[model samples]
Target: MILQLKEVNGMEEGERTALLAIAMNLVIFGIKYVSASATGSIALKAEAFHTLADFVASLTVFTGLKIAKRKTKSFPYGLYKIENLMSVIISLVILYTGYEIILDVINTDLTELRNSGFAIFSLLIATFLTFWFSNYERKIGHKINSPILLADSSHIRIDVLSNLIVLLVVVASLFGFHFDKIAALIVVIFIVKTGIQILMDGIRVLLDASVDYETLSKVEKIILDTPQIIKLKTLTGRNSGRYKFIEADIVLKTHNLDRAHFIAERVERITKEEIKNIDQVQIHYEPLQKEEIIYVLPLTEDKTSISPHFGEAPCFMLVTFKSGTETASKTEILTNPYANIQKGKGILAAELIVKNMVDFVLVKNGFESKGPHYVFSDANIELV
Candidate 1:
């Protein structure tokens, strides 16, 4: 099952990144707030609020990590959508703060942060730290394939750009140009743009849109390279947190229904192996047009059980359904190769049956799942 796919320590790594961001934001917040107070600069004050927003955004990402991994009775699928929800929350905060900065700048008396050496020095240090932190988180985000981490890092980059704008306000003030209001407006505009991008990213995931084009194309290529696939009917994917969920419909080249199912299983396994962070994949398949085939069964030594246990059966009994009826025309017995497998008896039995092109295996207890059932179903074989 694709749901079984996992990356070791992915969540741990994401939480570490988010926590680091939180610490960075706090450090920058104190530095910039002091800088804003000393210089009487509206632009620097806006940067302080921007850092505060970063702090909140970091908390949201950390919370998303916690919720994404948890599944409860009321939330059996886990809380992965919390990532999108957190992103939207972060975006709105950024947007609202940016608007506040714009109005504050437009109304404030235009002046350069005069003789504010400590303020400029502090802003520079915060800028360099924000830049480094954003870069670090971005690298880790890509490594873990964490959308929330990536989005949060982008949000931090907005801080870096805002710092640069504040520096521009300082330079313009020295020249008596007094472009502080205009420079702060530019920084707010950049913040709003980053917020919009973050919002779109979250909305796309919330809407269950198809996954990234590159990944979707990779999945398509892998399926086409599979040996027995006749036609790819549909290949679709979506995301929740760091994981991708895929569903595909395929047609098999073989006329035998059993053969078609075998192909679907192969596709599922290979795709999951090649693609990291795929938490689930469901395959719907069809066989190429073909003639009707035999009805297969398992039998005991005495051939007395129409309901013989497949694991203990000594031989297989093949029969044909009477035309347009549930009745069998006759029974023919063949040796069972997997009656005494040391391990994986069901799997070995299923493989043997599929190789012989058997259509069905009947069992009194219904069917064993995973190994044998997965095998049988993959080959379009059935148990009754």
Candidate 2:
């Protein structure tokens, strides 16, 4: 079930942070608007409008988080893109806030500041609150990997810087100098810069851009490390909101349909375990086609005679031949490195054979209920 606004304790971390930002912005907007009216400072009025924009942006983020959780019949994949859409809207709001500041700087006449002490004190309080909340919100945004929250946090950071500039102007007015218009123009630069960054990030996700290269590399390593996978045909990942969707095509060593499916499931499970925020993992697997067959036989110390004991054998002989023909095309003898091991010798020997890509094991007797038997069985290697 989706979390509702009424359930405060059960709400997602992103929703909680967004709601906090809305409340904080509202309070700051009131303080700035009061200070602007009392002092008649243009920069203070511009900051008041910017704080109001922040309030609207935070509301948009909260709404997006709520809607993104719903999975309708038309949107089987969920409305994850709503978060990115909200980010775009927030960016536009920030940009418009900057434009308004620029207009105020150009059109408003220079007015002597009144109640300078009150304006400076109020701006200091607003700046301190903005700085604290922006940092706190950003920490939660990264922890939950929420795109809208991160975008909103960045917008709040711009407020912190702008408030500081306006405070400096208010203090300078006490010295018979007024640079309120110049300070507001500087604040606009920061606002525009932040807006563009958020806009680009939102657009990329909305366009179905691939996930970062580092994440893709980590996934590739995980897939390649699986012993049953013969080759990885394709691997691709993309981001929807803050979650990742991964798809891969692989070739397995086993020809059995059930074994192929089992290997695919194992790969999917491991991939999800190793990666964070994975929404879905789709793995398409096929069996490897055999053009040649390899056989491994346990050998005695002399290397010429077959050993009846599979685990205690000192060496192993590998013979390779075309699938249809009986005559061997290549033969090699390999030392059994695990022959002297006191424990798990049979299992280690079986793993060595699997690593050599042996299709069959030639043995003198049955090895039922043995560790080696299960190992070879899992690899789909036949006993002859």
* Candidate 2 lowest-lDDT run of ten: 1-10
Give residue 195's error in model 1 in angstroms. Answer: 0.9
lDDT per residue as tens, model 2, 74-117: 99988888999999999999999999999998899999999999
Best by lDDT: 2
| Candidates' C-alpha lDDT | 0.79, 0.89
The positional error of residue 368 in candidate 2, measured at the CA in angstroms, is 5.6
Error of 2 at 140 (Å): 1.6
Off by over 4 Å in 2: 1-11, 307-314, 337-349, 363-374
Writing each residue's lDDT as its tens digit, candidate 1 over 124-178 gives 8998999999999999989888888888888888888888888877766666666
Off by over 4 Å in 1: 1-8, 253-262, 291-384
Whole-structure CA lDDT of model 2: 0.89
Candidate 2 is scored at a TM of: 0.91
